[model samples]
Target: MNIAKNMEAIFVAAIVIASATSFATAAVRAPEVITVKAEATEMPTVTITAKRLTAEEKAAL
Candidate 1:
């Protein structure tokens, strides 16, 4: 009876210690943010022109 109570107290103490240890080891780290900028430059663009062949050109083919 008394021994069982002591064993229960020890078990609870062990669980509490284990939990505290884990929490200490798993401490949260501060987050860091980094920013970068580039000198803006004009982006290149391409232009394409297309024309359909006439009926005469198609007949020659």
Candidate 2:
């Protein structure tokens, strides 16, 4: 039982080491950045008039 346990532990350790080594040896590439020019836009304006009403006119049904 003890021997089997030691072998299992060794197998797990070897797999972990192999995975880490392969990841370390992989090629790394840098990302690219792009520059763009934006066009300016004009905003539109709005004008409004306020009408006044009496309380008696507002409460009438």
Per residue, candidate 1 scores C-alpha lDDT tens digits across 1-61 of 6877699899999999999998997877868989888766986789778888899999999
- Point to the candidate with the largest lDDT: 1
lDDT of 1: 0.88
- For all candidates in order, the CA lDDT equals 0.88, 0.82
Off by over 4 Å in 1: 1-3, 28-61
Give the per-residue lDDT digits (tens) of candidate 2, residues 1-61: 6877699899999999999988887866657989997675866678778776689878883
